[model samples]
Structure formats: structure tokens, C-alpha cells
Target: MIDIIQPPKAKQVLKTLSMHDDDRHDDYFWLNDKENQEVIDYLNSENDYYDAVTSKYKAFENTLFEEMKARIKEDDESVPYKFNGYWYIVKYKKGKDYPIYFRKKDTLENPDELLFDCNVMAEGHDYFKLAGLSVSPDNTMIAFGIDTVGRRNYTLQIKSLITDEIFFDAIESTTGSATWANDNKTIFYTVKDEKTLRSDKVFKHKLGSSTSADTLVFHEEDDTFGVAIYKSKSKKYLIIACYSTLTNEYYTLNADTPDGEFSVFQERVRGLEYSISHYDDQFYIVTNADGAVNFKLMKTPENTTKFNNWTEVIPHREEVLIEDVEIFKDFLVISERSNGLNHIRIKRWDGTEDYYLPFDNETYTAYTATNVEFDTKTLRYGYNSMTTPSSSIDFNMVTKQKTILKEQEVLDSNFNKDNYVSERVWAISTDGTKVPISMVYRKGIKKDGTNPVLLYAYGSYGHTIDPSFSSIRLSLLDRGFVYAIAHVRGGEYLGRMWYEGGKLLQKKNTFTDFIACSKFLIAQNYTSPDHLYALGGSAGGLLVGAVINEAPELYNGVIAAVPFVDVLTTMLDDSIPLTTGEYDEWGNPNDMTYYEYMKSYSPYDNVKKQDYPHILITTGLHDSQVQYWEPAKWVAKLRTYKTDNNNLLLKTNMKAGHGGASGRFEALREDAEEYAFLLNLENITT
Candidate 1:
């Protein structure tokens, strides 16, 4: 049995190491003078090739981008809500540093009325980029988070939607999640002390408050983490989710006061699962605690706490993957995956009468429910997929009437959903763990087993990277390439057990599972090794780096996006953001056991002088999630140690963070570059 330890505990020994110690292995990449120069030489060569290939399409791509921008009434526009006889919509424009834009829904098409070039909210420091936007119920205030780069700490800022006047000082913390109270006067967010990663305190920021010094109403000091807080629709209770990393213990707290320290009202149906929604005062959580890919929907009475209160509303089905759950009035809309196809169903509270809704003409790979609102006569909702853009319509419960309000990007003549086919398949892992793999390809492709395939995966930190649509992927699939997502361990695939089986020392199972999927594809005659490519970003990028190091010959090309390559270095640094907090997820690396384990797989340190695959290492200059310097240093060292002169391309986003480009066109352009790179590698002409 492998004893996997997370790296946050490595502080003591690493702190003792002198910065001047030349023999110290604190730096992820340590190369001699000759090796350093050799790596630089290799980088220069790859850069030449990358530049030459990108140059041909630069002008054409720019022209296509400008043309695409011209068709949009605004760079990007959210659905407008009619309030106080005025149509209000959140508009985002290209080239604007700030996320906010002012636009009236009625004068949407008029260029003069649209505020595109200017920032609705004045620009702040680089660290204060908008994290989220929540308009008040009355449309008077806009609540948003301004997070500092590198540091996970943030200040929740509330601006008057009417006057655009800012109110209150920023709320700072190491918490990644936050929410506004329905009253709009108070903002509820989780804050962790820099010293301990496991302990968390919930703070309520009242509008116009100057400091968080006096605003902390509740603090959980033990080894408990709190997140995913939201107010009940009736405003009578506050629902907070608290979980322990040592044991998969989760509980729901129902507090009368939004920020009050409350007792655990209901224990979460433990093991591991995602709580999707809480509607009609009943919880709708997805959990595979029972086993397999099938999940159970357990709903307890409001304010009740007990296993007896946990009633199985929807029993698990083996073949179907319940992707999402949406509550609209008296009905619950369940989005699911069956036989690689996406479907939706409406179920009543009694579960007796359920209607299978038609989800015809799905061009994208994945979709999500946008919103649900009661319109007196009917309930209105919206849904969108990767290639399909977004569509909105209203459904009437009384009359069984369905009316389409608007379809996103449908008017664009250049929009083409026919370029891609989204698919879901299962591959067994080393332990015979059934992994879900989602694939995308152009419509009408022969199973000639010659098409290039890009397999993607991310398995760590209890995060689930679900399958969804991507418009940009069409650029690759339009050629003869197949893009697939491998749902491996460290993710919530079959719920908590699946994640447990893959986390800690068992983390290697994630990489092997990905490798297994790749082999499975080749064995099934879907694609060959010569044409297979693998890609992953961030933690997913960690997956890519590990796989390439472990089985480089298995792939023709590899793309590692914003990867955490310097795992050992990060876990040792106290100043580094989220390092201390992530101790629960990754063990302390300073200990001999953890240090040895991390050294075994740390990509930057593990770069050996051996034959390697064509690799693309892309990262952002301003990425806060995985530091830009990580990939920068890793590529520098890998180029030196790798025996072959295979293309090891490094493309760093100069202005973006982990998510890459903020603008729609800029993002698509980056995607186009990525797809273009993959297509060139596969010899697939678009």
C-alpha cells in the first residue's frame, strides 16, 4: 500500500535551508551553466518553429476575429431582466480591463447607447480583478469580489448598480468562495487564518463597513473547512456546508442569523458527492455513496438532522450519469448522461409522474441550466452547451406551453455546430475503475482508426472537471482530430469513494487511469498512438506532466497548461499563497517520507535525459493559480535534460491568469492557436 502524504507540512525543514546553500534542492529546476545554455538553445529552436507555423494564420485569424466581433451587438451580453420598467443586462466588452459594462436591453443593438469602450466600474489595482457579479433583487447594488493575484485573499466589494458608487472597504481572506445575503446589505464569505489551512471562520460584511475587525460573527476553529454558503429562498435560514479533510465528514448548518455560529442541523449523506441545489427547503445533492456511477438524491425535511431524515428521492441507475439538477416551481429538472447522449427530465416531489423532456439537436458536448424564474403564468429557464452557445425559453406548468424567448448566437451566420460531435465513453483503470471519457469530433467521421485524438484529464483536490461544450474545440474537430476528456481519480466521478480511491498516495492511479483510457482508445481502433495527443491545465496540467514523464512514448503530442510542476517547492514556501491551506490536500513535503514521494514525481525535478514526445508548455504571465514561473522554469530545465530535439513549445499568456484570455475573441484566438498547434502536430488540415 502506498502512503501518500500531501506537501503542506514540509515547512519546518525547508525554512531552515539557507537561500545561499548551493547544494539545496529547494528550487524546482537546478541546472549547471552548460545545461542552462543548452535548454535555452532548444527553446529558441522550438520558438522558431512555433513562430513560423503561427505566422501564416496570424493575419487570417485576426481578420476572422474582427469579423466575429462585428456580428455581436456587444462583445458579450447576459440575459436582460425587466425590472422597474427598465431592461437591465450585464454587458462585458473586449479590451476592457474591468469586467463591468453598462447597457440597456432595449437599446442593445445601438452602438451609441452601449458602453463598450469604458469600464462601468473604474479600474482598481491589478490584484483587484472582479471575481463575481451578483445584482441585487431590486437591481440597486452589484456585489462582486476583488481577489488579489497569487494570494487567494479577496475583498468583497459592493457597488451601487444605479450610481456605480462603491460602498464599504474590501473583505480580505484566503477563501475562494463567497456569496451575498438576499437582503443585499450583508455579504457572507469564508476566511482562513494564514497559519492553518484546515481551520475557517465565516464573516459577514455589512454594506459600508470599514473593517473586518468587528464583523466576524462566527468562527470554526477546529480542523473543519466551510464553503458553498447560500441563503434559503424564504430568508429564514442560512445553509452552510462544512466538511473535514481527515475524515469525509460533512454537515449542513441551518442558521437563523445569516452569519451566526450555528449547530449542525443536518449531517450530509457522507462519503463524497456534490450538493447541486436546495429548492423548496429540500436538499438535492448528488452522491454515489451507495456505489457505482449511479447517484442517489437524498432529501430531508427542512431543519431536520438525522440519517432517517435522509430520504432517497431518486434511486441510482447504473447506465445514467446524473449531470445536474434544477428546481423550477413544483418540478425538478434532472440533466443526465446515458449512452453518451445528454437528456433532461422533469420530476415532481412525489417521483410518481415524470416527463421526459425533448433535448433535440444538441450540437455541443455539455450544457448547464442558466436560470429559472417564475413569470406568473409560466416558469422561464435557459440552457447552453459548448458549441450550441445558449438558448432560453419558458415552460408553463398549467397549460403545458413552451415558448422560446431567445437563442444565444443563433443569428450569427458564422456560427457552426455541425463541426463537432460530443461523445461520452467509459474506460477501465488499472484497478478496473470505470472512468468516464468525453470526446468531441466533427460530424460524420469514419472509424478508420487514423484520426488524431486529444485526451484531457484533471484529477486532484476533490475537484470534478465535468464534460461541457466548447465552441473553440470545433476548430480542431473540424479537421480529423478527436478531443476527449478522461474522468480519472481525484475527481468526483463515482462520488466520494472514487475520489478517495485516487487521492493521497493513491494519486498515481489518476495518471495510470488516464494512460489506460489512451490505451483503451487505441485498442478500440478509435485512434492510434502516432495520432494521439494528451492535454490538461492547472491540476489537470499536473496530470499531463506526470503522464508524459511516466509514458512519453504513448503520446505523439502533449500540452501542459499552467501546470503546478514545482509541487515540492510550493509546499515548502510559507509566503506562497494557498500553500499552507492546501496542506490538507497535499502533505508536508519537508518530512523525509513526503519529500521522497514528491521528488519521485515532481516534473521539474524529474526531467530525465530520455526520448520525449512533442510537448507544448503554455502558461500565463499573470496566472495566480499555478505561478507563471513554474512552467517557465520547468521548460527551461526539461529542454536541457530531454535527450531528443522534439518540439517542446512554450507559449506563455502575457496578460492572462489561469483561465487564460478574458475577452471572448482573445480566448477563442488562444483556443485557435492551441487547436492549430495540435492539428499541425497531427498533420490534420483544417
Candidate 2:
């Protein structure tokens, strides 16, 4: 007789949650106690059960991991960009999991100056992330943030570039960024609330001083808003920006006067959203003022930085969304999206020349990259597509000449862009809206409803998942899997209106659009339900979760990573990280209307006595964004409510956070595990 591996059973304690005259009985609520030994044991058991179930395919998983890792150029280095008379470069040594930072002074021919070797600093830590590398104006010191536990709360530290010695100053619970003032000794950074992890305070710290002596420059008292400090591109002012989902306010201070009070550039307005970029004597603003849904470009003199003084520079277009603008000494480059495609438009400051850079690909991502030098005509940009590798290019605005600085190198010798085919297809949603789907597969794929397809979508927060190159995804395409990205309504793919149509009361449009895409694929003979799979992570994970609950039969299997399954409960609790701040995104559940609507589709609450597709859920215990308990409780509830005995597994990474793994190669292992789960569902073990 064959032995069957049994899954772990979580013991549930009944807990009643009451909100707005509504009561909910939560059986697995006890799992939310992070310090509870029972909770830890239950989580460990789930991990053990996942290991036992996948032990048979360990070799295949390793093979997949190696195959994906082999495609990465081990000793890869990023394109160097010049800043403060030095060229900065980030490179990884072969077999190392972390990056090494280097710099060349004056010229590229100069000997490389070793800044930081993350491999050495990451030693003894299972999870490590270094962020916010800010060099002092004098180029004698550097401020950076480090996180060892992967919770995103970093410790800000300063180091002497001249002496190669780390300073004694250290500030904890920061957002992992520090902006330096012109006076190299002073710096400004944002600090997060310990409980909610919200960036609520901005502090000014002076070098050679204790953190306790630091001054609080600004406090974002509104629970719905967060604050951040950044230096203007012109390097003349330090700005503190307070922002919420639909509102924004900014305070500015001359960088030379580190101790001076910051003056408010604009007062807060409930529906006003704007960002500032400093030029010679004016501030360029990208805003949705005057009901500009897609946003418009406006400018105000530095001396008169107020709404009344703002004048339009670029009018808002119904079909286009102004994503960002980069200011140069002689030009302005605007990043816009129109009809789900990226457009880079360069305009001369004197209004003499205005035109857009041309792109031929039907489905590709292109955007302006780091252009630290304000005096240059060269615009550095990045471009990639589903079938093409990513390339960093520099285009001279004056000469109309472009140069490819560096292209992503795929280590596999057999890899070729022509071997794959990518195309855009439209799916008619239930609401009669046409949603776009970008799909890539092997060139010889046949639309006979027999091939395997992985449909993915992240329909939340107006975050568009563009069609971009991914060498790692080649493992799936090469294995005869068709990967498709459903540009649903919740994202800003079409325009700001597309995102508006899928959020709050209309959030169901996101799920329906994804379902429409899957059905369209099946109807078009690309893949049938038996060979279709669903995949999403975080908000995207929530997408797949709700998807399976509404139409489980549409997908043969599903993968949800760090899913926000318990939506209603999470939104109701302001104490949860990102809860209060995201009230604008996911409506405040305190209101009865939002509460009822949220409960209607929340993945955990909707799980009932019905058949479900084979599912593999993954989460990180240290995930601050979407708590591990969300997924843990979700899996427990599904096991009890789901009628089918399809594979239902949960794997928790105890060492990492929202992002699964910190190391480049280690992250591939997580991807391999996920891909293995999907491939095994198709009986494609190798």
C-alpha cells in the first residue's frame, strides 16, 4: 500500500469580531499572535507538511532553480551613472549573493574605489538589505540604511569616505532613506511608527552627534498620511513631502541653511495630489489640480510657490497619463502612458523643440533612467519587452542620436529573442470594457486549447504590471508554457480612468476583467481550463485568491504569494501596517457600505463549501506589508471549507519579509519552488 502524506491541521479558537453592528466569527484568529507558541508550532507544522509533500520533487525543483540561475550573468554590473563628478557602479561577483558598490572619480579610467561590498556586510544574516546610499555634497561622507531582519525598518548610518570608517551615529526605525543637505554635516531622514510601520516623522540629524539630540523637523499627525524627506534635483533645497492616497503637502528649506525652518510650499487640500521638481528659479509640479484626472504639468516661481501662482505648462489629456518629469538644464523629459504604452517626450526648455522618442514594439516598457547631471543633453532611459532583453540607452536630445550603454546578458548560450513571440490581445470584460492582455510563449506555440498557460494580474493601487523582459520567466516559456499578463481595470494601464474604474466600490471589475481574460484565452483556443493556471503576489495574490473563490474551475492550479486574503478584517483594523494609509485605496471598512462590499469578496471570508483549484500559498513570517497571519489563516480556512482534495499547501519563509529573499540567487530559488509547483501540477517534472 502506498503511504499518503497528511497535511497539518491548525487548531482554531473561536473569536468574535464586531464592527458597524456586524459580527464575524473567526476560527483561526488565534494565529495572529506572533509570540504565541501554538501559532509558531502551527506555522512550523505547515512548513514541514509542505516539505514532506514536495520532497519527491526536490531534485526537479533544484534543477529548475539551477536552470533559472544559470541564465543570469553571475558577474553582472549595472550601467554606471555619473553623479557629483563620480561614476557609481553596482556589480555582483560570481557565486556571491550580494552586490559590491564601486565608484570612479573624474573618469571611467580612474581606479575603482571600493565603497561597500554587501556580501561582507551581509555576513551572519539570513536576510539583509542595504538602501538609501546618499553621498555628502563634499563627497567625503556617505549615509546609508541597513535592514537585517527584512521588516523594512532600517538603521541609518554614516560612514567617512576619506577614512573608510563608519561613524558612531545611528538612527533606528527609519524608512531606509536619508537626504543630505549642502552642509555635509547635516542630514534629514524619515522615521517609521514602530507598531504600524508608517513613516510618520522626519528628523534632522547632524554628524558626530547622538541620535537623541536629533531634531524633529516634521510630524505627519494624520494617520492616513506619511512623510518623506528628499533633496531637490537642483541640489539647492531639502523638501519634506506629506502625502496620502488623494492628498499632498510639501515643505521646503534651503539646503545651505540646515537649521532653518522649512516653509510650506502649498497647503493641504483633500483631493489635491501633486509632486514637485526644482529647476533654476521655479518648481515644476505634476498635479491633478482643476480636475485633471490624468494629471498635468504646472510651474510656479520659487519665490511664489503657491497654488494661485501656478501656471499650466502641459495640459492634461483624457487619453494620456503624465507619470513623471525629469528636469535638465536645457530640456524637460516627460514620461507618459497612452493606450497602455510608455512614451518618452523631450521638450526644449525654451519651447523650440518638442518631440517623442519612437518605439516600434507593440508591447514593451520604456522610461527615463537616472540622469543626475542637469547640464547634459544626454537622456538615459531603459527599455525592455516580453521577448527582448532589457537595455540601458542614452539618447542625445540635440543630435537625435542614441547609444546602447548596456543590455541585460542572459548566460544561456542557446537563448535568443527570436525564439519567443509576444503579442497583445483584447478581452471583452463583463462590463463591456475591453481589457488588454500581453502574452509571451515559444514561437511554435499552437492555439489548440492544449497548451499550458499562466495568467497573472495585480489589480490594485493603480500599479500597472507592464510587459517587460524577464530572463527568469524563460524557464516557463521554454518549457512550453504561455505566460500572460492581464492588464485589468484596477491598474493604470489604460489611464487614470482605468484605475478609478476598478477601485473602491468598483473593485470587482479587476477580478471580472481577469476572469474575462482567462475565458477569452480558452475561447480563442489558446488554453483550456484544464491547462490554465493563475498566479499573483501581494495585492496580485489577493487577485488570484478572490478569482478562485468566484471561478475556481477556470484555473487548474493557483499560486498566491503573501496574499492579502483577509481584506475586511485588515481594513477595519487601523492598527495594521498600511491599513490607515490605504483607506483611500481599499475603502474604510468602518463605513457599513465598504464593510459589506469588502466582506462580499474578501478571499478568506468568501471561502465556502465548494470545490477549489489546486493551490500553493507562500508567505514570509516577517512580511510587514501583508502579515503572515493573513495567508496562514487563509490556508486554514480553505482547508476546512474547501470540498476538493486538490493540493493545498502553504510555505512560510521565516527569514524574509514582503520580498521573499534578499539575495539575487536566493530569490530565484523561491521562484523555482513556485514554478515547480505549477509545473508538477501539469506532470512536467524533469
Candidate 3:
């Protein structure tokens, strides 16, 4: 390893942020100015130091990268799903960095017709992402959104399938989707505010017309809410959904009448959340109405689309949380979670039969997959766990027979699910809450405190971190490492109550819960603080940052990827992405109570002059979600305050965004680098 004579110093400019009559000094606030040459130089210097520090482990990183890459099948394709007389497929060719989309008509024997080649679109761009690939109702034209810069401001364009012509008519700064009206010419899309980056406006555009000629269909005036447009599965109505963290409201437009105005299916009510799906004569509402904290199902007449006219289809259940619903002609598949594991309950539309699809593992993720056809008896779903490869299965709803359509093939022949063991364990928190942790390790690995363990979690926005299989994780498992996921409170792992208990005023519970899980593992001899490490991304990255401030002694090292560390400052500035819309999750800092509460645990605000664990902080210059400046500023602050001579590194992906690298193989290189860091720190060398 290269010896650093002296760590580079970041020039500090004293800047104090004021909130609730209190002042907090942010010495590194100037780092947020991305245009400054000094700021860019600092980031580049940090990146150079990171590379130099890890130079000795480059061979290990390469081996790790190659092994992980080898595990993945060179040429992989997704299970083709039938839509509108054509079977659509997304496949990756060997050595290609992008997916190629194709469609075949009527049967598998038909030749695949090329639709879009992302490889061609992604050329000459540092970052590229294609989203919302939608074919027109007539299947004559296609509308897709592409983001070349990583800010998520996509430029939408239309393609003529018959003429093989790409139109230059571009709609900029969209939410990366376009919902086509039944007429196949009128398209509705949502646009983000330039400053706030909130999707607040919906507009309608007719083909062959200029974007300036498009009409603004609707505008969500509420700063806390955002809007999106999509067509119902039934293809009868174009739905406009405006939502915030706590509530949702939907408006419907008759697809047949392109010129007609949309009417509200339900008016917006605070704390009232619902999503709609259409059947023959009624609209099904999956909602948390009438004190159904865990959510329930209801139905209303097509014409009388008010909450008052709704009738219960599946009433509230105290133990179950309805995560999603899939409607079919003969079945209503309810994707739910109970005991922190997913369960798909299939019920006949007539209410005659009801049963859950069987899942073998103690902790595995299973959810309803694409079932666009309203006439099918077969229900498609996906299943996987820490040890199981993902499998797509089609189950005969009537016969109760499951046929595996495709299972992910791990190219490495040495890989075997039978060689690994997974367990669902519980950890007791300081508040006596039972936190579930799913852990997996290679067979014959002893559960002793001497072994290394990587605890991962994302405990915010009610996003559950389900136990899913990863081919890349095999490298860790095979090297005497145990992988565990903490089902902490902020996630809806247990139910809505669990999420409620960990957010807003109770947000500290998330950090404490993670710490508690770590202590429990140590107390149980699963791992010790000396060998324990933590990993989280984005808000979860915030979780790692906050917990380390509170209990730095409990971890040997931790990785924070694209973290939102400067919470108080970020939340106070509504111009940042996700700030205005996230008031409900992390209460608006303008309010004194929220300001004080957030100030109490804000990671960057709480950085103290004390020893901390070895840390690896990463970010992207073009990250649209958590700005790269947050982590950059955080590392700068830590350098000034921390007393530790222990390792501290910062990696900035100049070409990537929130999600690091976009390519299939390029992403593995990042995973390899992370693993190399962990392994090198553990003194594992070959």
C-alpha cells in the first residue's frame, strides 16, 4: 500500500446554518458549489487518494470482479410476456453494455423484430438510462424516455414502427414516461419543476404537433405532492395520479375522448392513501381508509367513483399489509406481507376460493409479476431468497399447478443453493421491539464472533429490503463471511405501524434499531464489533452515518453510498431533489419541532471530535437523488473532526448518478471494489 505522508486538507470557509433560533457551523459548506475549480480539485484529489490507497488490492479487486462477472450468464434474457398480439423481450448480448429490446408476433417460432437497441442509444454518453418504453395502442408508434445526463431529466421521443422513422419531436424534463391515449396520437406526460425537481405538471401532446402547442392538462399546485400519468390495465381510461408521502388522489380521463377533461375519481384527503385498478363495471381501490392502518381493499361503481360509494372487498387485517393488487377476469391476486415475508394470496373473482401461493423458504420475497391479460387463469409471479436464484413461475389458478417458466442461471457451475444455509433471526431493540434479521452463510461456517459479518439495510420511505438472491454475494459467503439484512422499523417489514414507529419524530428509532441488531448479533456470538461491518445506500446510507455517530464503537468499518448526510440543510433547501415531497417522511425542517428533532440526529450536524470506525463514503457527481455534495461535504467535515488514524476513503463516480454504473458488467466492478475494501480490511490476501 502507498504510504500517505500527509492527508490532503480541504480549505474551509466558515458558514453557519440557522434553524429554530439555533446556529450550526458547516465548515465545508462551500464544497456544495460544484462549479468551483477548488471543489472539483478536492474531489479529484480524494478520488486519487482512494485509488492509491487501494492500489495494492487492485489484483484482488480484479479477481473479485472476474469471479462475480463469471457467475452471471454472458447472454441473459428476461422471460417474454405477451402484450397486444406480440411477445416483448429484453435481452443482453455477451460483451454488450446495454439491453436490446425485440418483439415477436403470435408464437415463439416467429423471428424477433428489433425494436430498440440501447447500445446504439447509449453511445458517446457518460451516463445513459432508457425508461417508459410504451407502444401506442395501434402498435404503430413507440414512445420512450431517455436520460443521458444522470439528473433524471429525460427527453422523450416517438418512433414510427412501420416507417422505421425516429421523430425529432422531443419533450424535455419529463418524469421519464408517456401515457398514450386510446386514439394512439394523444400522449400525456408529467414534467418536473426546474428548481425543485418535482413532477408537478401533466401535459397532453398530439403527434405531428410541436411541444409548444401541447396543452397543460393538469397542474398540482401543492408543493408536497407530485403528479404522474398512466393508462389503466383495462385500457379504457388514462389515469392521472397525484400523490405525496401520506396521501394520493387519482383523476381519470376517457381514453376514447382525447379532448375531454379529466374528472377526479377521488379527491385528495390527508393521510388517505389509495391506488386504483379497473375491472368490468367497477374500480377496485387498495386503500388505508377508515382506520385500516395496514390497508384493505374496496370497490366502487365505475360512474360513482367516490369513497362514499365504495364497498369492502377485503376488509382490514391487523396482521397483514396489502402491498399491491393484481386484477384478472377470474382472479384477484393480493400481494401482501405478514411476519416480514411476502405472500401472494390468490382469490377467485367470485369469492369462492382463496389460498396463498406456497413459498418454501422461511424468509423469501414473492410478488405478483406481469399479468396484463385480463382473460388468463394463470397467474405469474416471481420468487427468490438469499440462497435461491430468482425464478419466474406461472401458476394455474384453478389447478393449483406451478410451472417454472425461467430461473436465473448462475454461470458458475460451483454455485449451489444447497451449499448455503439461511436463517430468519430476531433481534430485540432498546424499546423491546423485535427486529427481524435474515442471515445467510456458507455451509460449515461456524457462528462465532471471530467471523466477519456484513449487515445491510434500507430503513426509510417504507421500502422493505426483501431477502433476494445475489450472485455477487457468493464471493463474501464463500470467504467465511455472513450476510445479514436487518428488517428495521422504518421499512414496512412488519406492517404500516412498523414504518410509522420509525419515521418523522420517531426517526431515531431507525438508527437505534440498527444498532440494537448489531449488538444482538454480538451477544449471540454471531459476530463481534471488531469483525462486524455495515452497508446502506441513500437513506440507508443516512442510517449508517447516523448510527455510527451514536455508536461508533459497535462497528469496525462501514460503507455509506450516496448518503443524504446533511439532512437539516438538505431538507431546509426545497430546491434540492426530493426535499419538498419528503416532508411527511422526514418532517419539514421549517417547523421548530421538526428542526430541533432533525438537528438532534442529523449526521453531518452531529459529527463530533471523537474516534470513528474506518469508513468508505461514495457518491456520484450527477446523482439526481442525493446530491454528491452531501457526502463530499461529510468527508471533509469528518477529516477536520475525527481523531482516528484509521482508514477513511471517498470514491466519486464522475460518470454515474445515484445508481453507480448503468452497465451490466460495469456495475459488478463497483461491487468488486467494495468487496475488495472489506476483504483487504479483514487482512485476507492470497
- Give the number of the best model, judged by lDDT: 2
In terms of lDDT, model 2 sits at 0.94
Q: What does candidate 3's lDDT look like per residue over 392-504, in tens digits?
A: 99999999999999998888878889999999999899989999999999888766688899999999999999999998999999898999999998999999999999999
Candidate 2 ranges with C-alpha deviation above 4 Å: 1-3
Instruction: Give the 10-residue window scoring lowest on summed lDDT in candidate 3.
Output: 1-10
**TM-score, one value per model:** 0.76, 0.99, 0.99
- Flag the better candidate by lDDT, 1 or 2: 2
| Residue range 1-686, candidate 2, lDDT tens digits | 12188788898789999988888999999999889998889999999999998998899999999999888889889999999899999999999999999999999999999999999999999999999999999889988999998899999888999999988767889998999999788989999999999999999888888888899989999999999999998998999999998899999999999999999999999989999999999999999999999999999999999999999999999999999999999999999999999999999999999999999977899989999898898999999999999999999999999999999999998899999999999999998999999999999888899999999999888899999999989888988999999999889999999999999999999999999999999999999999999999999998999999999999899999999999998998889899999989989988899999999999999998999998999999999999999999999999899888798999999999999899989999999999999898888998
Q: Which sections of candidate 3 miss by over 4 Å?
A: 1-5
Cα lDDT of all candidates, in order? 0.62, 0.94, 0.91
Model 1 weakest lDDT span, ten residues long = 1-10
Error of 1 at 608 (Å): 2.3
Residue 92 of model 2: what lDDT? Answer: 93
Clashes of each: 16, 1, 0
Candidate 3 RMSD to the real structure: 1.1
